[model samples]
Target: MQKKSIQNKDSLKRFVDKGINEKELSPFDPPDAYNPLNIETIPYEKMHPFLKELIDEHKNFAEVLSKFETALMNWKNNNWIFNDEIDIGLKQFFNFFDEKVPLHNQKEEKKLFPLLHKKLIEIGEHNSVDSSITGINLMEDEHLKVAQAVAIVFNFLELGSQLPDKRSREITFELAYEQGMAIIETMKLHIFREENILFPQAMKLLSKEKLDDFN
Candidate 1:
């Protein structure tokens, strides 16, 4: 009985040691496929290259917006010690909107929307004998509204960058946070509508030839 008890104790100690070693191993040291950030977006399997490209761009914008939000949180948590950092992050977000987002949106507005609308009309899903309102018009209206809301956030950040005092910095950061969240909320819905509604309608309604042209 004593010998058996000793053996069981040794086995238990080994298990405990193994558990300790595993816990001590850096959780941050993960393989690339582990995806520590947990990127959660809609799965768009087997889409046209053009639509896929737009989806990828939207995903990139979301990531950048996430970073900007993190910067704002950090600045707020640390008594606004990182005011300049917030400005830097905000600039990155705005530049993405200015330099990249507009062109991506324009591609949809100029190429994707017109082509998709014509195809949807032919199929009689939109601009029909009974229903004249098209998905294209809805998306375009959303684009204008999203652009305006995003512009407000950008302007707030730009003005906040020139804040001269801690009080002003705090006040401006608070205002920017509210405006930024509103913009993100609206933009996220706009993106969802496009990805879920508009893009899918295009994929389903348009022919292989038309999709090839867009690509």
Candidate 2:
């Protein structure tokens, strides 16, 4: 079992190295795999208080993502050279993720999504094969993926900075860059889906009392 585990680790490392060295892994334009729901975004002024607060948080998170992207670009353009600006940007991004994302996700998963899940089922918005597969499920899955990507990026960046060899450091940093880009893109998409699709659906389907309960 230990030998198999070692082999698996080696395989994963090789796969990551190949991904960084051979091809572009940063772009996240999925071709028709994820179609946005045809709903319009409820204006911020008209959103439920709970949702308005979430949107405000989203705006703050977007700012952090923008800064992080700039820092990542600078790091890459400088041939993986680490700098104080880059360090600050990475720290801010990770800090926001650690501090805010969990609480936001908790509100959605625990307070909002359960109710929305039931409403989606009532309106036949769920998958035919599986009643549990609603928009909420997709959003929740993305939440988990975002957390995983953030951890991978953080670990790779830390590991790269501590590595003894230049080539090893470059490889790890390259992987970190790819994963970081994925985090930014995935998060932007997730927020869009929630604002335009899931939250609107919640407002439309859920009762005023149900919505008020969010407060």
Candidate 3:
């Protein structure tokens, strides 16, 4: 009994060390063999251009966010501040990311989701149709949360025009930077959920014949 308990404890420890929980591993897997960008099963070379573009865009944004976060952290710690031009650049980037990016997502939610739901029903599965509708609605709600947070960042940055000194600029910069970072984190998880969970399900339901007309 003692030996069995020791082995079980070791097994659990190994699982934790390997990050082998169902929630962690399941999200990384694709719904089916048709998805070329399924990271767990497919190599990068095998990915279609569309899927490659999607992944590349997400990764590039993540890199930019990391750089901005680092700059903000350094500013906070060492007081190595930025000039007006840098402040303006940061504000512009936040505005573009928050405003323009969500338009693409809104397009997906408004146009794509209903069409996808219809396609699933045409394929003869009521369950799939219902599931897609529910899932896509939830995803759009998440997008709304991120968009609202981003609007707050944009509004705060606009107040920079009223800032009197470099000290106030620094303070405003930090606030905008933190708000943008929070929104970026939400956007990252949103991308992960869509690409990993939603898109694969879509691909499985949407046949080549059905997608050809849209393409």
**Largest TM-score belongs to which candidate?**
2
lDDT of 1 at 191: 71
Error of 2 at 126 (Å): 1.0
For model 1, the superposed segments whose C-alpha errors exceed 4 Å read: 1-43, 78-81, 121-130, 160-172
Give per-residue CA lDDT, model 1, range 72-190, as digits (tens). Answer: 67766876565677768877887888899889888998888987767755755443233444557666776786677677756666677687876887777677676666556556555
How would you encode candidate 3's per-residue C-alpha lDDT over 123-206 as one tens digit per residue? 442323233334455566666776676677667667754687878877776676676656655565566656665555565666
lDDT over C-alpha atoms for residue 73 of model 2: 92
Q: Which pairs, if any, clash in model 1?
A: none
- The C-alpha stretches of model 3 lying farther than 4 A from their native spots are 1-60, 78-80, 84-92, 98-103, 117-133, 160-174
Q: Report lDDT (Cα) of residue 78, candidate 3.
A: 54
* lDDT minimum window of 10 residues, candidate 1: 9-18
lDDT scores in order? 0.63, 0.75, 0.53
The TM-score that candidate 1 achieves is 0.66
Give TM-scores for every candidate, taking all chains together and pairing residue i with residue i: 0.66, 0.83, 0.57
Could you give the C-alpha RMSD of every candidate to the true structure, in order shown? 17.9, 10.0, 10.6
